[model samples]
Structure formats: C-alpha cells, structure tokens
Target: MRFVRESGLYPDVPVPEVYAWNTTFENPARAPYVLMEFIKGKAFNLVVRDDDPGLLSGLCAVPESQQVALVKAMARLKASLSKPVPFTEIGSLVVDSSGTFSVGPLMAIYGVSLGSPYKSIEDFWRASHEQRLLEKIPNFCARTEESFQPSERFTPHDLMDRYQKLSALIPYFKIPEPYTPLVLHHPDLALRNIFFDEESLLSDDPKVACVIDWSGAQILPLMLASCIRIFRGHRYTGIVVIK
Candidate 1:
C-alpha cells in the first residue's frame, strides 16, 4: 500500500487517502491485508437512473485523450514494480507483472471461489482447498462454456484442452501485465469502487475518480476485455487501447 501510494505515476494526482494501513502482523496464522480509508463511492450497479441514468453517458463523454492518460498511469504502475514477485507473498504491491491475475483473490473475497489457485496464473486451482472446480482444462472449458451462449468461435472443451490458443489472447485485450509478466489492472476499478467529493467532483471532467476494489486484477486479456465491456462506459476514460 505504501509503495504504490508513494511511488505511483499519480503520486500527485490527488487520489483517495490511503493513510491507514496495517501490513505487519506478529502472528503468521492471520491472513495479511492492508486497510486504507474506505473510499466513499457509488457502484455502477442497480442500473443508471434518469438523473445520472447509466454509466454509458459518462462512458461516451470521455475523450480519446483521457483514455491514453489512464493507460499511461497503469503502465507507470506496472513499470514501478520489481520483477519475479513470488506467488505466495503477493500483497497489493504487485511486484510480479505476470502473476497479476484476478480470479483467486476475487473469488475468495466475494464468496464465489472460482476454481482454485493452480500453477498457471490464468488457471486457478484450489488455493488451499481439496475440492476444485476442474480436475483438468477440458473440464474447466466445459464448465465455462455453460455460462455463455453456445458459439462456434470456441467451445468450453477447447478452452480447457488448448493452452497456446488462450495464451495468445493477451495482446488482443491490451491488458497490462504486472505482478507476473501479464498485465497491471485495477481489478476492482468500477464505478462502485470509486470515491469522490460529490457529483460536482466531476465538473472539470467527470470520470472514475479513484479506482478501488483490487480483487480481479492481473493480465488475463479475455477477462480484461470482458470487464471493459461490462464496466467501462461513456464516463470511463482511462482504458488503454492495444493499437
């Protein structure tokens, strides 16, 4: 928490106050987590109302220029990290660009538990559980395919069995790889996770003020694109395009 807050590209960007943190512990049994000033923000859920309507309005209004700036910010965050961060000690510091994945931590926090923490960052195995979602990749694909409408582009089985094809998707999504060589992303960077003074906080140029919720971050391109499609809107100006 301190490293990022102290050395980020936006050290001067006036983000939410990360003043309170307790990253140290005498007991090894306790899980390590840092707490900051819980940002006062609204989520982009429950549909946009007539007043603000939806995030689409905010999404469309963001100029292409701001997108570039946000992308640069993310890049800076990635660049600041040291390389080869061990898998076990990965706190919020994000030292490994490639290991920066979203699934394990996200599922754990939200009570969803998507699969488990496996060898592959993109793939999850039981973090420390006996029961996992998939015994192998084929099973994983079959399971994932069940959620989406059937399509010819690929099948659930293909996803499980084919590793090379899935790896190729990293570039197409323009997702950043931090923590492991994959990508650096604000996994929880959504409207609900943001914090600001008020609606007037956007008088200059309303956008996602300070992205919070670092649950599902990392360098999964397909998943990143999925998030952009679902969370980003007219007001979203910080996404980095691959081109």
Candidate 2:
C-alpha cells in the first residue's frame, strides 16, 4: 500500500490508511485485527464479468474516449507497479530490527512449510520441484492409495521421469539467471480488487478510484511476473515446427 501510494501511479485512487494492527494470536480474544480507513466504492467486477470474451467488451460499451483513457491508465499502472529487485535472493522482503530491508523466507509471512528463500531462481525451482514430488505427491497418494490397484501405484521411476521432463523445460522456458532483476507482482488482479469512480468511468477522463488487496505480493523473475489470470483474453498467434 505504501509503495502504491508513493508511486502515485493512480492519483485518483485512494488507499485505505491503516491506523492500528495486532498480530498476537496467543489468545483467541486478542487475535489479529487491522483498523484501516473505510473506502466507499463499488467493485469493478460488478460492471465487468470475468467470463466476458476479450475482457474489453464491457469497456467498449462505454464512450470511445473513456475506453481509451481507462486502457491507458491500466497500462500506466502496470508499468509503475513493476520495480527491479535489489537483492539476488528469491524470498519475501523483511525489515530487520536495525530498520534495514532484506530478503527472507515466505514462511515468515505466510506461515506455510515453503521453507527458506533461495539464493537463485534455479535453487528455488529445484527446491519447489523436490517438495512437490517428495511431499505433495506422497501426501496425495497416501490418501488415494487404497483406491488404486498395485499396478497403478506411482513407482520411483515414474516420479524420476516426470522430474527429468520438468527439469529439461527449465532451459526451454529460459528461467532467469542468478542476480537477474525481479519485479513486485500482484498475482491476483481481478476486477473486484479495483475501484473506480462510476461517474468518471464514462466521462471523457476515466479515473480509477482505488485498488485494494495487496496480500501475497512478491518480487519474482520477470518471466513469472506477468499477470496470467488478467491476460487470459490476450492471444498470441505463432507456429513453431519442432522436428
């Protein structure tokens, strides 16, 4: 929220000001609670349906000038939100007692068993692959093992072959090298999180009122930073014949 405010990417938008917070979970009565400024505006999702084709049909329904302005504003926000990572590590950002920012494990913030942060993207990939194969697969198999016949069991060789195939794709996808620049990405950019002034939406100059829900934002490789869910409507045409 501070980053968005400081960037001034959306001048018309208003981010709620946090007045206080309590993270103590030892007592049920003292559980975490965040007191923030109340923002009044309808969610953008109310106007645009997620299943709408081209993701532009709703916008196109408005005046041509408003449509153009909204598109331009969205593009500018995307560019402004992306920033280069200062460190070479792949992890969540943390501020130490000395008041210095540094990279730390995702577990610190999410409290999951994701383990520590990696020094390189390759390390992150390797650890993630291992975790999925070793931990997730086994846990899933255990729950459904009784339903499968003995011959249908997933053998060690099966897992190895799958791992090898995924490993080979690393180079094909062109995963970034160590110390490569990363950008802070909001994985979920659904329309519901965006707020706009309804009056201005159809005016000559459309203005975004605010964008909320910054949870799970992380600095990651540019290749993985693209908003996949939001860009699903965009299509690329190409053909590659692999002999």
Candidate 3:
C-alpha cells in the first residue's frame, strides 16, 4: 500500500487502485490480501505459441531473437533480487495452474533442488572420493538424508570414509560439486507463463507488466537458469531480448 501508492507508479491513480488493503470493509469484514493494478493483455503463452516458435516446442525452432529476449527477461528476473526467496516462494515450487505436473512435486518432500544430481540424492552416497567439494557437500547431503527415506546421510567425514571404502571397488565414481550454490536458476521459466506485446518481438509487454505466478522461480546462478531453458516447452523461448 505504502510503496505502490506512495511510489510514483502511475499518474494520479494507478490502473486498479489498492483500495482497503485487498478488499472492502463496506458492511461485512473481509480477508486481507495485497492489491495491484490489472492491465489487459494476452497471456504470453498464447502470443508466444502463435508468434514464432516457443521453447515449449522442442526441435520445432524459435527465432534466436525471441530466445534472446526470453533469456534477457530471465536474466532481469533472476538479477532483480539479491536475497533468495524461500523455496516455496519461488514460482517453480508452486502447483502448476495449467494442470501440468511439476518436477518440484516429486522433490518437494526431500527439500532438495531437482537439479541436485540423482546420485547425490541417492541412499548412502560415498563421501570423499565421490564428492568434488569434499567437506562442504557432506553436511548438505546429510541434511537431506536425515528424513529422506531410502537415503543414507553422510557428513563430510562420513563421506570421506565412504569414498575411501568405495575406491577399492568402483571405477571413476565422483559426485560433482553442488549445483545449488553454483548457479542462479529460474527452474520454472515455461512458455505458458510468458506474455508478449505487438510492438515487442516476443514480449508484447517489454516493461514486465506483471510477472504472475512466481512459484517456480529460483535464484541459483545464470548457468542454471540458462540450462533450464533446455527443458522449456515449445511456446517458451526463455526470456526474449527485444532491446
């Protein structure tokens, strides 16, 4: 209320004014909710699906221009903040509005990022010889194994012991560095979620009118965000870089 109202976002009145928190207290009491202006526009998914080609359509092909814009948008979204929102707040973790099942649904119980290699998520992971970051990773892995069924926890020291024991039996067994801290990933930048404008190539509203449903958003690193682009649907081409 204070920021949007006081902040000069519009002329005298914003498009849809935030009246009385989120609701009106005319006669009956109302529940509290945040309010913002509503702008009429097509969902980016519809425009992107028809405009050119979306990342959603794998192998179908989208223009490099559109793809670039999507990346830029992702970059902006990813770079906009410094602190990481709770995993639940990130858009990717939310239930999909389109009835599309999310990878998050499966991993939500584990408190592990899906990008966490399957091995790291496995039961009884070898600590030292298998892990790249030796010590820093063990505690993190152990944290997950504590409650995760079918998985064994390994502290850094435990991992080292496991690695030493496994060295004699396995060939080239190495768990890579943690992907969590390495990259800022927008894990759920899907095509169905983006909107575009006529003037803007892929983005009809280049100014980021309003980013709806951010349950899947993550803040790992640029590489992770870009790599997730690989999994985007045909309609999505990552952020489309117009300017």
Candidate 4:
C-alpha cells in the first residue's frame, strides 16, 4: 500500500492505513492478523466485467467512456510499478536491526519451511526444474505400471534411463541473468482485489479507491514480476507494447 501511494498511481484516493500487526499467537490454532483502516468501496469486478466479455455486455452497464477510463487507470498503475529499483542480490528483501534493507534468502519471505532460497537465478531455475522432474517421474512410473498388466510392464533399468535423460537436459536450459533489476509488482492484481467507490461507476472518470491483498507483493525479476492478470492476453518483455 505504501508503494502504491508513494508511486502516486491513484491521486485523491485514500489508501488503507495500517495501525498495527501481530504475527505471534499463543494458541497454535489462532492465526495472526493485521489491524488496519476499514475501506468503504465495492470490488472492481462487481462493477466491471473485463474478464468475461459476454457477462460484461449485460452485467457491466457502465458507459463506454467509463470502460476506457478504467483501462487507462489500470495501465497507469502498471506503468508506475514498472519503474526499476536497484538490488545487489537476487533474492527477497529483508530489514535488519540497523534499520537498513538488504536482499535476503527467498525462503525468509516465503516461509522457511517451504524451500531454501537461491543465491542466483540460474541456481533457482535449475533447482526448480530438477524438483519438477523428481516429482513427475515417480508419478509417471506409477501410472504407467497401473495402466498395464505385468506382461506389458517395463524393466527397472528402462525407468532409470528415462529419469537420467530428463536430468541431463537441465544443464542445457536457458536461465536469465541473476543481476536483473527488480521491480515492484503485485503478483495478484485481479479486478476482484481492486476497490472503487460504488458511485464512481456512474462517473466518466472512475478512480480506484484502493488495491487490497498485498500479501504476494514483491520486488523481483522483470519477467517474474509482471502482473499475470493484466498480461493474460499478451507477453511482457520489459518493454511496453500498446496494442
């Protein structure tokens, strides 16, 4: 929310203010929560149906000018987030005791129980590719054995060969440079997560009151940081291509 406000993406709009946060709980079952300002606005999806053109025609009764304005607003927001930010390492950001921010392990931000963070993008890509193969090969072998009788089954040597072949291809995979500039991005920026005044729908220039759900927001690679929802129909190559 502070990033959005500091970027000046939505002028005259109020961003939700956070008073406090509690990440600790005495009870294991009880989860942590954030205390923040209450925003009064309907979800953008409730007013506009950009994801569904069929429903958009009937459910989205707003004027064409308003639709154009909404698109422009979204584009401006994307542009604001695309600005480059410097980082010495290729990992998640963390604040230390000295009140200074630095790049830390990715697992620090995405829970330590999940997996360890990589020091370079190539290492991360190689680990991900190998992990996927490790998971799929076992499942594929089980499915193949179950679908056929004993007489049609392949030998253990054949299965090992298949696994070896897949593993050998990992080195040839192309990985992006580890030092790519990180950009601020909201990984989940769907219309359902956006908030706007109900009355704003009637105006020719509708402004987004707030964009909620910043749990997945991060500064990452340009390719990985691009908004999936906004670029569903197109590819984001770190260059703005208006069509």
Best by lDDT: 2
Off by over 4 Å in 2: 6-14, 26-29, 47-73, 95-100, 107-113, 136-154, 168-173, 176-179, 202-205, 231-243
Best by TM-score: 2
Pitting candidate 1 against candidate 2, the one with the higher TM-score is 2
lDDT of 1 by residue, 1-243 (tens): 333355453343235555443334754536555556665544334325466654434433444554454344333333333233224322222334443423243233353544433444334322322233234444444454457665556665554445445445533533244323323345554445544445633333333445565544443322332333223433444445432
Model 4 lDDT tens row, 1-243:
544454554454356876655556854547687677898887655554567654533213555555555655566566656667655444555445554655555542345421324555567666665665566667556664446566855655566776678667766654466526566666567656777777874465666777776653565666676544633443223433333
For model 1, give the 10-residue run with minimal summed lDDT: 124-133
Cα TM-score per model: 0.37, 0.66, 0.36, 0.62
lDDT of 1 at 49: 43
User: Model 1, clash count?
Assistant: 36
Model 2: how far residue 119 lies from native, Å:
2.1
Clashes of each: 36, 1, 43, 0
- The pairs that clash in candidate 2 are 13-209
The reply for model 3, stretches above 4 Å from the true place, is: 1-37, 48-62, 82-187, 203-207, 216-227, 230-243
Mark the 10 consecutive residues where model 2 has the least summed lDDT: 234-243
- lDDT (0-100) at residue 145 of candidate 2? 36
